[model samples]
Target: MRILQTDPDDARFAAWCGVWAASQRADRPDELPRPAREHVALGRRLVEPGGSMAGTHRAAVAGDAVVGALRLLLPVRDNTAVAYVDLAVHPDARRRGVGSALLEEAGRIAAAAGRTAMVAEVDEPVPDPPGRAFARHHGWTCDLQESRRDLALPVDEDRLSALETEARAAGEDYEVLTWRDRTPDALAEDRALLGRRMSTDAPSGDVPVEEEHWDVARIREDEAAHLARGRTVLTGGAVRDGRLVAYSELHVPLEEPERAHQGATLVLREHRGHRLGARVKVAVLRELAATLPQVRRISTYNAESNRPMVAVNEALGFRRSGGLSTWSRRI
Candidate 1:
């Protein structure tokens, strides 16, 4: 097998996406399958504005066909010693060394870039799925476990109203506000602060993610990238003393109108305990239901150990759909 670096627009990239889509279906059947265009858009974003990392794509070719693909993400500003690698092997090509060959090439690329460790995630409905088994066999240790949850849209109105009332009572000192697609100029700075807080306040378990630095420019760049991919962003926040103290965002992808994604819900440490998390989340869900009636499901992931966040989600009618296991190994 030979590994060749390829562009995302290459004709062979579609074959790589086929492998990825098949793998996702086998691993997490309940989730929406990403199309080839989404993968292409992701590739473009990885190398574009406000991206803190550089991405490399490699395809494993055996004889005349592509059987596997690997993407290596190397941080450009922080965690420079680490590389994130994702590998997908065609179902028909498994057990033929396709995955191993791709992983080996990924290792070489990471080492050449001075990376000391590599990380990847495996999705499983249970703890001992084939993907986890493969990662263990390859000497990668499970570093973190995230529970993926989905909320069916148009939630029971009475239950939702009760929860909203409870949250409002708890956050009597705070007021909720919302916007679509872009951050309002009045709240842009505070929104940036909350975005940065999201990285530092959330539970990371054993994952080695660094605190992300955010500002108004970075926020606008992120919004632009989402728009470029034909996705709409909805944001809701809790304000106290004219400053954003808690926030949540929902992303609706144009390619899949029936599905949405809960991006982040964060309440500043000092503002925690007032049910602001639940308030912001419920506010966004209500707005989404009213504005984007076609969205039937919204998915979000939380570290299993994040009990407070998990409780908030459960209170908002989210159910456990699957789990993600992150594995890491030293190069």
Candidate 2:
């Protein structure tokens, strides 16, 4: 078996998608498979190599068939000391050393880039999954466990409306604002500030996370990337004293309209007691339901220890779907 560095061009990209889809189908058939076009768009981003995020892709091949693939992401700005790795091996090729070969290459590449630690995540419906075992055998520690939840759409309209009414009353002093696609110019600065706060406020469990600084330019870059992937972004925020204090976002994929992904939902420390978290989340869910009626489910992941956010999600009718274990190893 030979491992080769691969570009995300037409042929290699197709092979990469095949490997990833096959692996996920075998391991987690209940989850939605990532859209191929989204993979291509992300490949373009990874290949550019000059932004806050950059990555290298490697493929493990046996003769003419690509059996496994690995991606190593290095943050160009904050968290420069760490690298993220994702590995996928086709089900047909597992236990034949394909995954091991790919991981070895990833570690070599990450270490060469001056990264001190390498992090990876494995989704497990139960503890001691194959992926977890593999990581453990390689001397990786499970540092964090994240709870994954999903809310089936067409939520009881009457109940949701009633809850929204209560939340609105609780946050009577704050005004709620909603927007789609892009952040409004008037609220961009406040939104940027909130984005920075999200990095520090959210629970990270035992996983090391650096606070990411955000500005208008970075916000625009993120918006552009989402647009390129043909995804719709819906945002809801609470404003007090003409300043944005809390926000929630939902992403609907054009390629897979039946599913949506929940982004960050954060309320400033000074603004927490007013039920703004629940208010903003409910507002955005309503907005998404109205604007993207085809979305049947929305999925989100929260740190297992984040009880407050977990309560908010539970109150919004989300049910536990699965869990992920974040693993790390020193290189």
Candidate 3:
């Protein structure tokens, strides 16, 4: 079987990969975005900056038909740090050698760039037997556990109000804000400060939080990109004395047109005990309900060991969906 690599923007390769992905997902019990096209679009945007040490892409055409594929995201922080990998195999190609070939290629690409590690993630509610087996066979070790949670739709107003009151009484402050096309200049600055404290408070494995900071220009560009796809980003922050301490972002997946996903929530180190993390999250949910009335469900995830976050999500009426274990191997 011959292997071919293509830029995510290559139309012919993308169409072939999309066709294969559609056929495979036809039998699944749960819903997921069609793989190949979604990944291709992701890859294109990630690789646009010039002199980016990392590579961005999608791959297909192992041997005969386009049976399986993978997307590789190079790191933005450490030049030598191997980046994220996203893979999918056509249903009919399961148990075949296609996946193995693709993974071997991934290792080669990493090794060529002197990278020692690669990271991957999968959503809950998806069966991952083949993926689990591939990692094991390749000597990749499972290192971290992430838990996914889903918030009920048409949020219970009385229950949400009670939670907010309890959090406030505990010395925390909460506010939810929504914007049209751009995040306010002041909020963007707060995001930078909040980003600096994430590693200290959030669950992180051997991977270091790359010190790459986001400025207004960067955040603005990202917002425009999201809006271009018909999605909306709403920010919820916890503040004291006009200073932003903790924040969370909720994203509506407009392309899919049905579900909304909680992006990322963080609380600074000095503000941990007051339940600001949970308060900000629930606040985001309330904002989404008010703004986008058509959303069906909202989902978010945290490391399985993050009992604090888990407890807060549960308090806000989000149920445990399932867990995903992140696996990695050195090239």
Whose lDDT is greatest here?
Answer: 2
The TM-score, computed over Cα atoms with residue i paired to residue i, of candidate 2 is 0.96
CA shift at 299, candidate 3, in angstroms? Answer: 1.4
- Stretches of candidate 1 above 4 Å error? none
Q: Which is the winner by TM-score between candidate 1 and candidate 2? A: 2
My TM-score estimates for the predictions, one after another, are 0.94, 0.96, 0.87
Worst 10 residues of 1 by lDDT: 45-54
CA lDDT for candidate 2: 0.86
Clashing pairs in 1: none
Query: Sort by lDDT, best first: what order?
Result: 2, 1, 3
Question: Candidate 3, which segments miss by more than 4 Å at Cα?
Answer: 16-20, 23-28, 34-37, 50-54, 62-64, 124-128, 172-176, 206-212, 228-230
Candidate 3 displacement at residue 175 in angstroms? 5.2
lDDT of 2 by residue, 1-331 (tens): 8888776674676787788889888877876777767767776777664567888788888888989978788888688888999899999999988888888888889899999899999977665678998999899988888988999998888878877888888879999989998898888999999999998888776666688878887888789888888898999999999898999999989978898999999999988888898888888988888888999999899986788899888888999987888999888
Q: What is the lDDT of candidate 3?
A: 0.68
Clash pairs, candidate 3, are none
